[model samples]
Target: MHFLQQVINGIAQGCIYGLIAIGFVLIYKATETVSFVQGELMMLGAFLGLVLITVLGIPYWLAVPATLLAMMAFGFLVERVAISPILGEPAFSIVMLTLGIGYVARGAVMMIPELGTELQVLPVPYRDQSVAIGGLIIGMERLVVPAVTAALCLMLYLMFRFTRIGVAMQAASQSQSAAYYMGIPVRRLNGLVWGMAAGVAAIAGLLLAPIVMIDSNMGFIGLKAFPAAVVGGMASLPGAVVGGVTIGVIESLAGYLLPEGFKDVAAYVVVLIMLMVRPNGLFGGEVRKKV
Candidate 1:
């Protein structure tokens, strides 16, 4: 029973990591650039929800849509104002820029009065509720996380598989020059991809806030999600989900069965082993570069 409980907990946390990993994969596919600020973007999303619910006294249902829209707009502005100018720069520069953005975001959150210093609780009705099945008990909030993650993954899959924009994004990812020649509006697509990624991050944040305290440093969990992305294959969306669950389960088992702090290091150790054995990730395809 205890083991089952730990597995459930791990799955819940893994779902958040999976969602964040989706953002990482999306941006990488669109621009071949990793947005180191994705975790901070998640933090910002949670803060947005906090402001809406706590400060404005908005209902949770209403706050969700409002937060998502705000995140979309924020993502659009970020791409246009910060990322677009450096589009042609070296990859390392873009990475550093994202890191700077993350730091600035975290710093700005800390500058907020009262909210920055103290941990804030998001009062969701189902936060502490749970369900029991036989000898296993599952928290509703924890169950919701993985369910939502799966639904989001399905929605994303459908968007990319059947939608025109999805096809355009796919084309652009494969070859930007060809996509542009085909009238795909690659640049605009890139911006949209960023917006989409940010929106996803927002969803991740909102879901996570109920499970953990909302704070400036909450985004650091993205570090774990990064490993999830790598283990699943950075280029594969489904792989992200798989990687997240695997990492989550591993971490959960480790935390319960092993010494303290084992769970924290489990994901990274798995990632390191995976990288040494399969550099492209479990589901990632091999890319050959012509010299």
Candidate 2:
């Protein structure tokens, strides 16, 4: 039962990582660049939620959607103003730019008028609430995280798989020039993809805030999630989900079963093993180029 409990806890945390990993995969597919600022985006979203609820005296339910929409717009503008201009630049330059953007985001959050580098509770209604199943106590947060993550995954799958815009986005990701020639607004789609990714990251932040304090450094959680994206296959959405849960479970068991600090490095260990075994990831497709 104790072991089962740990597994459940790990699953919940893994869902959070999965959501963030999905954000990473989204941008990668849309723009072929790994945005290193996802963590900061999540942090900013959480902070924005905090501001809306506490500072602006907005209702929690209303504030939630509002925050998501606002972050989406923020992401759109970011892509248009900063990322879009360097679409064909060297990969190293793009990555370094993303890292700089992350730093700017973090610093911007810390410089906010009323909320700066301080730990604050989000005051969510679900905070400190939990339920028991089969004699095991589970927090509402643990339950909410997985449920929401599943819902988002399904919605995204449907969108990308069925919607016209979704097919267009996929086309643009495949080749910008071809997409543009086909009359698909590749630049516009890229901005929308960035917006959507930011919105997803905001959802992650909101869902996670109740489980942990909303803090400037909370975005560091993204660092942990990066392994999830890699292990799952950066190009596969479902792989990201599976990889996150796998990493989360391993970390949970390691925390209890392994000696000393094994929990901290467990995700990386899994990544290394996965890389050695399946370089294309569990669900990732093979890539080929004719020389």
Candidate 3:
């Protein structure tokens, strides 16, 4: 029963990591660029939700959608102003610029008069709610996270499977020149992709805020989730979620079963093992050598 409890807790936490990794996968698929600011985006989203709910007194339901839209627009703006000009530049340069942007965002958040370096609670309705079933108990937010993530994944899958815009994004990611020549607005779609990814990150933030609360350093969780992205395969969306859950389960089991401090580094250890064993990742498409 205790082990089952850990698994449930891990799944809930893993859902958060998986959601962030999905953002990573989305952007990478669209632009072939890795944005390290994803964690900060999640943090920023949580802050936005907190302000909406607590500061502005908005209802939690409305605040969530509002935060998601705002974050999406912010992401679109970021791609246009900061990343668009250097579209063809080296990946390293773009990565550095994103890192700078993330730091600037964090600093800006800290500068807000009502929000400083202090940890703040997001006044979510489910803050203290819990559910028990068959001798296992967990918070409502924990259960909600997985359900929301699963829904979002299904929605995205459907979008890609049936939507024209989705097909165009796929085409663009595969070969930008070909997509452009096919009359697809590659630039515009890429911006939208970033926006969508940011929107996804915002959902993650909203779901996670009640569980972990909001803090300046919370964005650093992105580092742990990064391994989830890599372990699942940077280019595969489903892989990201699977990798995240795997890491989460491992961490939970380690924390309970292993010596002190193993929990903190367990995710990275799994990532290392995955890299050594299956660099392509589970569910990732096979790499082909060019003639």
Give the alpha-carbon lDDT of every model.
0.91, 0.89, 0.89
Model 3 C-alpha lDDT versus the unseen true structure = 0.89
Q: Model 2: runs farther than 4 Å from truth?
A: 288-291
Poorest 10 consecutive residues of model 2 by lDDT?
Answer: 282-291
Q: Can you tell me which runs of candidate 1 are displaced by over 4 Å?
A: 288-291
Clashing residue pairs, backbone N/CA/C < 3 A, model 2: none
Residue 235 local lDDT, model 2: 89
Instruction: Report the C-alpha lDDT of model 1 over 1-291, residue by residue, as the tens digit.
Output: 898888889889888998999989999989999888889999999999999999999999999999999998888889989999999899999999998999999999999999986899988778779898996878788888998898999999999999999988998999888897888888888889999989999999999998889999999988888899999899999988889888988898999999999878999999989999999998999785443
Q: Tell me each candidate's TM-score.
A: 0.97, 0.96, 0.97
Q: Mind giving the per-residue lDDT tens digits that candidate 2 earns over 107-168?
A: 88888755766788898888789898889999898899999999999999999889999989
Each candidate's number of clashing pairs is 0, 0, 0
lDDT by residue for model 3 (1-291), tens: 889989988998898899999888988888778899899999999999989988899999999999999999999999988888997899999889888888998898889875758888888888788898876778898899999999999999999889999989888988888898999999999899989888988898888888886887788888888899999989999999998898888999999999999999999999889989998887677874344
**RMSD per prediction, one decimal?**
1.3, 1.4, 1.2
Which prediction has more favorable TM-score, 1 or 2? 1
